[model samples]
Target: MPALQTINVSKSYGNFKALDKVSIEVGKQSIFGLLGPNGAGKTTLLRIINMISVMDEGKVLLNGKPVKQSDIRNIGYLPEERGLYKKMKVGEQAIYLARLKGLGKQEAIKGLKEWFEKFDITSWWNKKVEELSKGMQQKIQFIATVLHQPDLLIFDEPFSGFDPINVNLLKDEILKLREKGATIIFSTHNMASVEELCDHIALIDNSKTILSGEINEVKQRFKDNVFEVSYRSLSPLSLPAGHFEQVETQQQNGVFVSKIRLLNGNKPNDLLQQL
Candidate 1:
């Protein structure tokens, strides 16, 4: 059974529709990229999954059963906006949030300590959240989100406010979480991150799901079959007229490299045979 599933979910405010029959299935231990442009209902769908808001129609399922209010305890969410309490001390706020997610005081402290040490932020434990930099606070909130070992994790634009090094750090940790049996719904506009991290993707546009499937399959579906081939020969090879349309050609190190697209709808194998 999929770890999470939404069937025909929809939401609206006043006369403006926010979501329209958006559906997605997230397999266990897999990374599912929720991709969309601004105001495309990504946040609304996430709110429905997080139970922060009720859907106007359809149901959200966990492990093949309809999600119950009680099931929310097993889910973790880190929204795009900052959620940390600014006046609270870093360690204190993290422990408080982790406890709210069902961790005990002792367990929360232990888990949070380990994460802080790993991130080399142990020195900031006693510092107030208002005193930390934006990137520092983001790390603290991330630790709180994952400390309780939730079954499903939702990260909305989690890469905000981080340097490239920290971005790589967070990316590695996300992959590790999936390897350890957590299903993740990652919402972001970063196409490079999507290509690097996601096994599958669902693209929403105009408040509706316009694409959903395995990542490579989706890319292939959207691809125009263009090919570039390099050959070492005595002279430059010419493509047969009416068979292939040449886009560009160049010579490098006595090798002829040709870029071509299908003009006559010739199969890729036919082009290779022609070469």
Candidate 2:
């Protein structure tokens, strides 16, 4: 059974539909990508899952059962907008949030220290939230979110405010969480990250899903039958076949590299034999 499932879920504000009969299943230990342009209902769906908003139509299931109000304890959420008490010390705020998520005082402190140490922000514990940089605040937020080790995690634009190195660090942590039996629903506009981290994805457009499937399958479905090749050449020359549609070609360090999108019955091996 899927760890989380939404069946024909819909949400609206007045006459404007925010989500239109959306259905999706997030498997256990899987990284599912919820992708879309702005105002495509990704946030609406996430809000419904987080219980921040009510769904006007359809049901959401957790572990094959109707989602219970109390079941939210099994989930952790990090919204696109960061929310932390500016005046509160990082450690204090983290402990408070963890307790709110049902962690005991000792457990919260232990987890917070471990996470802060792992992120190399141990010295920032006594500092006020405002004193920390945006990325540091993000790390604190992430630590608080996962300290309880919920079975399902929802991260909306998690890479925001992070540098490339920190972005990669968070990605590694996300993968580690998945490996340790957590299911993650990642909502992001970063298509490159989607290509790298998603096992399954649902693309939303205009409050509806435009595409949904396994990542590899979806990429294959969108493939243009293209191939890229590099070869040594005695002289600079181009292939003279109408069937061989060369999208791009370049010569670098005396080697010819070209990208070709096949049109008719043309094959890369045929082109290679000719070469």
Instruction: Please report, in order, the local distance difference test score of every candidate based on alpha carbons.
Output: 0.89, 0.88
Q: Per-residue alpha-carbon lDDT of model 1 for 72-124, expressed as tens digits?
A: 88898999876688888999999999989888999999999899888989999
Model 2 agreement with the true structure over 1-275: per-residue lDDT tens digits: 99999999999899999999999989888999999998899989998998889999999999999887787789999998777999998889999999999889999999888998898889998999999888888888888878899999999988888899998999899889989999999998777865699999999989988898999999989988788888888775466677777788899888988887776777767777666
TM-score of each: 0.88, 0.90
Model 1 Cα RMSD, 1 decimal? 3.2
C-alpha root-mean-square deviation, each candidate? 3.2, 2.5
Clashes of each: 0, 0
Which TM-score value belongs to model 2? Answer: 0.90
Model 2 residue 243 lDDT score: 71
**Which residue pairs collide in model 2, if any?**
none
Candidate 1 local Cα displacement, residue 237, angstroms: 9.8
| Model 1: residues with Cα > 4 Å off, grouped in runs | 227-241, 246-259, 264-275
In candidate 1, how many clashes are counted? 0
TM-score of 1: 0.88
